[model samples]
Target: MAHTIDISVVPPPLKSDWNPPAPSGNSVSPLVERRLLPAGPAYLAHVKRAVHKLTFEEHDKHVEAENERLGLNGTGANGEDDLGVGDEEEPEDLLTLDAKEWKKQDHYAVLGLSHLRYKATDDQIKIAHRKKVLKHHPDKKAGIAGDSNDDGFFKCIQKAMEVLTNPERRRQFDSVDPHYEDLESEVPTEKQIKNTKDPQFFFKNFAPVFEREARFSRKQPVPMLGAYDASKQEVEGFYDFWYNFDSWRSFEYLDKEINEGSDNRDDKRYTEKKNKSERARRKKEDTARLRGIVDLALAADPRIKRIKQEEKEAREAKKKGKTGAANGLSAKQKEEEEKKKAKEEAKRKEEEDTIARAEAKKAKAAAANAAKKARRAARATEDGTPA
Candidate 1:
């Protein structure tokens, strides 16, 4: 075992940038420099051959380790746990979603942010998108069963990213979010609220709904639906605020797509007209819905009746005091009574003005209805029909 080894036959140690030499028989070189290796399939294949290969499991573990090292494996920017072990399996329908029909897709669900929905911040969305890409990229899924050229879910992720990254587009999507629609559908009806025996039911149920709706308000610090014991002013202010709510919500997201590849100007115009009409209809319905909520809240408010009763009692007490202390009051007391009377008179005048305005509105409506009926009658007579 002590025989001398032949040192002359050993090749010189390769430099740091050394590359393998081309085969002697072949005229063309297959040994591409590492810098130039990514340019073509042939060069890439050569590079792969020179590298040590890992099994699929080992590759996945390597990727996971890299992700962890990069701080991409823990909680997201919004402080929610990253989509991992405990997340629900995606639905078959979601997996099969057509990217072409992106308008119909739930972008938040596609990005695994359904629980957060519109509340999910931009950073959170980005993190979720990246996680999805890493897990479901086509290259990563190579050799996996049922994987195909049609990367429907991946395409959905890209579409979702495209929409949610743009502020205007995200707002449009949020406006008509189906999650909100579901929440609205679940809101207790006016009849149900009115019939509930529990005194706290209104506050308990409607508080959450109003809070949810408040997010759409253009104005900040939205007034809340207060508890049963809330002050008269507090209750009145809440109703007033909601009744005149200026919402940023719009129906542009639900606009119907123009027929694909149809370049006819008339067709485009017609589609635009329909979309505008639909937007108006939806806006009107939404306004009515909000008005109904306010109306119901006003009708159900216990504070209004209590305040009215207190006002009546105070009025009666003042009357009794005035009658009983006809000539026995001090100068200060007289002055106080005079001020109180003046204040009451001003309040009365304001109430009368409000009533007058209401009466005028009714009269105007009646006149309009009478004019409409007259027009219909005249038209009927002209057509030789019954007036």
Candidate 2:
């Protein structure tokens, strides 16, 4: 007799309903395209999906526990209240109180100025912020405000300052702010109208302030290539733009070479890749070298002999200037000043030598002319009986 065998049915694991957002068009950099594309988009997408799944799972667990504790059966969890649950059946008004507290602490509303105002004049805002800090700094108000633990409030202030100061970050913050929602319903101010409508007017009003803050932060200004006219008068900033391109291209080429090893020795594709890689590497090194040179020049490149001379001079000058030489003339400064002075002296001496050569040539020419004239006169006297 044949025995009947039973097979247990196994089901496939559940597929994730969630999908990661597509990469923004601007997110793809040329460097990324060249170097990272070979790694494959699927690998990146897989990692992103895994992370999202994990995050969603955690959020779901937290929400389920919160709902169970709150006794809000069948109600969806909305992140409206920080205190998600109450011990007993809580009044609806208590739920609203938490939301009210959150609303009261709206950072954007406290700093009621528009994005344009902040962007147009960061210094003025900074000054205003400094004043507000002095006035509302939890430490200063601790005795009156009754909150001895004011660190959280101070932290909030700092966070607000940081957000408002950054352009991209401020734009993001403005978009999410309750005030942004109200802006559409409210009448636009004359200043707001002008900023929105007139690009030139806006730039004129804001660029100086933005530039000043950027300079203070030690940032380089954005280049405007089209603004320059080569056909007109000599451009002041042409060399800077040229150097920037050189530095960027060289760096790009060098980096590629380092990361991607050389293997295809005879291939045109390989050669181009190698060229790009080396160029990038060399550019970085050159930029670093240039920065070092600038620092050395600033320190007044000094020689040992010049350093001794400068130290001696500084001591003498200090006596007359009424400044303390011991404090003023550090070893580094003395060396730098000496080297600078030596270089200047060498240049001066070279110029003097050139001048002396020119003068000697003129004198020799004059003497030669006189000698030739004398010789000719003597010859005429010898030839003629009229001597």
Candidate 3:
């Protein structure tokens, strides 16, 4: 039995008489009609409706097959011992289920959160979902089995992500806007709800939300690689904190203190000893690694050996006040000198501009005051007031 499905027909917009591109390839009935192209957004609508129809058809076949398998089609009717498979008409297909039945399995309720009765920030919804998932995840607890555990939690997360990310589905489901509007009204077309039940949708939706959260929330600066120089103290500090475990431990303690209402840990000596030993070990390892690399490179190249010998000889000559053509300045010294000069010039210009602006502002104020006094005196004489 096919239930009466209310399929509202929306006409093409009146402003432009554009036709959709004809369905391509060999086919009996071209899936999309060419008449509905002008309304570009509704193109997705047409596709979704087609998909829904196909899904319903497939579901109808499945129900019929199941009924046959269960002997519900009178195959073993009337006193036949059919092993309790019950010779009754198959329960109505999914399409036959009324709106009330559909409401029982609402996608929003599955997420363990209230359906939106009003607008809310995505963060609020996300927090609610996280709490719900944590409560329901069996791995986090114990003894719970089947759908109430990880599987159900994951399904709910997926559904919520799908419904929220798609503007059309959310608006329609939330009753903020009707799925079908007045045919001739100025109602904009919606993107059709996709039929994907895949987990990939969750990740795709999650990335956008994650990016939004990271962008708006003030986060500790992340250190980037290749930032090396005097001008990058903050960058170096960011990396230093990031690479050190103490920063992470401190953050964890702070979070615990905020949430749990206390922070009292008395084990200090052991922690200090452990941290100091770890740092010393790491530094020693790094030094050995660098030294091994240098030794390997020098053994592989005779030029490095000659260069070191020449450098040592040059330093000795310089100490003895014997100068040569290649001895004016080293690259490192020149770079440092240039940096110092630039810093001094920048500071000098800043101070000069500061004084200049201050003096100009003082002069302008004095001139304005003198002009105001003259205007007041002229006004007093003109009105024959006491002057």
Candidate 4:
């Protein structure tokens, strides 16, 4: 007997909101939920989807917080305004500088390192250059009123950077630094030193002069011009050092400008030749000037006079001692005299022996020459040649 199915009475339809019964206790973890999902590009796409979108208000708040943290709106963590580095006002004349006359421009000033000058380090130069570029770049002044397309000052800054960044070029520029030249000129002349009545004139004036000049010396730890009461050796050593001073300072900075755009090798050669000659002339003049300074210092030095007087006194004392010894001879003195006489006699004998040897050598040489001549004559006679 087959069971009759109740097809007419179907089970009530399940509710639309019906879900599976909750498992054991807590909710599924994100890791477990991801693992349970189907693996493929669909999973990756779902993982990459944004979980939440920031409202406009939240984004503005975030930007404000970042700006405050970074000090972009001025007042940094250090309580100082972000005014930037190298904000010093440039001179009007400097701004009007011609790029073509870059050699005449103060490179340090152009880089805003005028105060530091040659003392500015490589890093300082780079910082200064960056600052100047930010301040004076043509693009920065593109639409400014009264600012023409003149990038002359900008070009000058570039030239200054080119010089200061290169060790050799920086040195060349430093060699003829105009401010230092002015300082050198201010050093008292020989005539001025001679005329000065102040007792501390030499130390007050010459000390600073030497200190300034010592910067150019190839050899460091330069001996200084010491105080007035310096010992004879000290004074002498100072003079000796200056007299032999090997200066690294050169005159290339003062070289005449070569004709630009000229392809003539002869013009270049001529310019180089003229520059070299000028350098040599200046070097010679500088040496002579240094020598003159030394001479003046020596002449004016009271220590030199004192040393001379002391030497003279020592000689006189020594002469007096000799005179006293000669006047009265003790037994020991007599013995010493005899020994001295013997020494003199020995020295005389040696001199006579040396002279005898020299004479014998000369005679031997003469005899050899005569023998050679005789042999030559004999040979000539044997060969019936002119004797």
Candidates' C-alpha lDDT: 0.82, 0.48, 0.46, 0.80
lDDT of 2: 0.48
In candidate 1, residue 338 scores what lDDT?
96
Ranking by lDDT: 1, 4, 2, 3
Displacement of the residue 248 alpha carbon in candidate 3, Å? 48
TM-score result, candidate 1 = 0.61
How much is 242 displaced in model 4, in angstroms? Answer: 1.2
Candidate 2 per-residue lDDT, tens place, 1-387, comes to 999999999998667886778877785546544445435755664565577764656756755787676654322245333221111232333222332233234343333333333343565446444544654466676557542434454454456577678776555444334443353233223446344654344334333322322221222454322221232222224224423433211122122222356465566576677777666565466456444433332232123234457669989987877655554677669899999999999999999999999999999999999999888889889999452
TM-scores for all candidates?
Answer: 0.61, 0.20, 0.18, 0.59
TM-score, cand. 4: 0.59
Residue 10 lDDT in candidate 1: 72
- Scored by TM-score, the top model is 1
Clashes of 4: 0
| Candidate 1 runs further than 4 Å off | 1-89, 147-150, 327-387
Worst 10 residues of 1 by lDDT: 79-88
What's the candidate order when arranged by decreasing TM-score? 1, 4, 2, 3
What is the lDDT for 105 in model 1?
88
* Comparing 3 and 4 on TM-score, the stronger one: 4
Displacement of residue 90 (Cα, Å) in model 3 is 31
In terms of lDDT, the poorest run of 10 residues in model 4 is 44-53
Q: Which stretches in model 4 have alpha-carbon errors above 4 Å?
A: 1-89, 148-150, 312-387
